[model samples]
Target chain A: MTDLSQQLAFVLEIDKLKAVYRQTTVKEDKDRHENSAEHSWHIALTAQILKDYAEYPIDIERVVQMLLIHDIIEIDAGDLFAFAEQQDHAQQALKEAQAAERLFGLLPPQQHEQYKALWFEFEAAESNDARFAKAMDRILPLVQNMNNNGGSWAKHKISQPQVLARNKHLEYIAPKLWQYVVQQTDLAVSNGWLKKD
Target chain B: MTDLSQQLAFVLEIDKLKAVYRQTTVKEDKDRHENSAEHSWHIALTAQILKDYAEYPIDIERVVQMLLIHDIIEIDAGDLFAFAEQQDHAQQALKEAQAAERLFGLLPPQQHEQYKALWFEFEAAESNDARFAKAMDRILPLVQNMNNNGGSWAKHKISQPQVLARNKHLEYIAPKLWQYVVQQTDLAVSNGWLKKD
Candidate 1:
């Protein structure tokens, strides 16, 4: 009813994120898929660790915030596989926007708007911070796939071209990580971890 | 190794954190225990959401950074149960310091020092940022226990005095949240969720 109640409610509600599993598996626990909560944590840390590689000066804090809250929508909308063959971007966007409204609405009014805006900025990937945050989002799982012998990339029979195309925006956002991703993709192909196109 | 290699190595290595489970369970998924990675994420977000409640002017970014990398040592040192009747904090400090060296060392030399320093700062919990971050860490699991019908508290036969004693530092760092915890503990005791000492 009050602000603290709303804050606690929001905090408790987001715990559901820990249950929303992604296709990618953890390095040590290959049998278990990484959940949205941990995925958010890893990428927020990744954004900070890789801040120097960003193409533009960015607010590392804002980037971390975006990365942290970006997947709260998945608490309700559910994780859509990044490598899925057919993605209804419009439909997914609508679902996530609705999820954002409900999830962020659980916070106090100011934070509700602030977090909702950050989530939108992350979805749009327009600002330097948002772009860098999005880059961290894509990059972590790419390497996680490498860690688990191709992980979901191999599971879904994904090709190198698809991986490159999905992550092509990295070239502009983070040229250094783009180079790293390209090199890793080459290694994955040679090692038969990622299928050749 | 080049800085890039070291950075990527750090990124890949911390994925092991996802496998390090904590004593708390997720609200929706009571059957599963929360892992260190997600716990880090939740507390970092919690620090941001509750920044206004801090006793002093704190850098939310530093708080988030501290929370994000704090548990990373669990990748090597393993999680020490907060409710354990007898804690060898001295041994934990030694093990975690060593773990910090190996884990943070995976990064470039600069981050290795930066993260290691932040980890130590968090462990000390003396600074404004560190205290707030530490508060979030304690409060999250406290409420998770309440959410899941006195989760680890019931399982470990923990008591009111134990919970209050464990989180007593919140009184100085975050008065509002400390009050909230006191109230919640009273309710938890009345509801028979938590046992009386």
Candidate 2:
């Protein structure tokens, strides 16, 4: 296939991301789960809206790209609940790296490298943009839980400490969003929607 | 509300876009229509993938941002099918502008101005970035149709002339993508998936 064909193929392949559902419920409809594609969109938009609060000044464009493609691997690896115990970090990373190679490799050579690098940067979560992007990713589900009477938290019986631990990066990377998360989690506990322990 | 609260409110409200279904079906599942949110995600990715084909050099960050938030008005005004006859574009514009205000207005003032301006620029489609963004928007549905064996075209009995006419902007703004569309449409017609004009 030619370069355009390769790019178009990648586009079509990534459409499967729309069907890969996460544990978080859509705010409008509690019965339904949020798919990775829309979740990616929400976080990309969040990166722009909340960039002002990032502890490190970020290149917003890179952050948006990182957020956009960050979840494409979910199409293959499937979403592992952030709070799930007995998690296999090593296995998850291996699966996602393979998935990333296959998906991003569908693009032309240059774009494949460009997008693959962004995905890796996002996975590393160390750069200014990556750190900020990860914070938004963690915070969206936290807010979604608050929106739906502690959505996934109540469903999974998640505690405030667990939530905070999963999102600890936000403390140093996005102080304002971290504060918002703390306030929301406290409210969740007070409302009896989250575990107090 | 503080800026953070206002921004969070906007985020929650825009979640409604995930429920606003477009005519195009997810390529993976024929029964399910593509929602505005995932469609926005796809086009944003397309803007990055196809940026090199633009008639003019575009600040892709602006193009991607424009695409991400463009269909958000569909949350209130709802999607308008491109090939539908008797489209009251003036009325459509009125509804979308109102929706834009109510939705983007949920953001803090500065961010509101920034996003709303991007939305309006996409609608105008006059600038280099806006023109290229518009081209990507038009091509996505067309490709979706071709991918699913004239998915929407056969469903609506749309003709080649109609498809070309609807996506005429691509001819000038993204000539390479326009060429790809022509080739795909010809293939669709040959396969008896699209009506020949």
- The worst-scoring run of ten residues by lDDT in candidate 2 chain A lies at A81-90
C-alpha local distance difference test of each model:
0.87, 0.87
Off by over 4 Å in 1: A85-87
In angstroms, the error of model 1 at A177 is 1.2
Which pairs of residues collide in candidate 2? none
How much of the true A–B contact set does each candidate keep?
0.88, 0.58
- Stretches > 4 Å off in candidate 2: none
Summarize candidate 1's per-residue lDDT along B53-129 as a digit string, tens digits: 98888999999999999899998899999865455777887999999999988888899899999999999988988
lDDT of 1 by residue, A1-197 (tens): 89988998999999899889898877688567778999999999988888998788899989999999999998889999886546576678899999999999999999999999999998888888888888888888898888788888887888888889878768998898899899999999998878899
What's each prediction's TM-score?
Answer: 0.96, 0.97
Model 1, residue B17: C-alpha shift (Å)? 1.1
Q: Compared with the real two-chain complex, what DockQ does model 2 have?
A: 0.77
How far off is residue B180 in model 1, in Å? 1.1
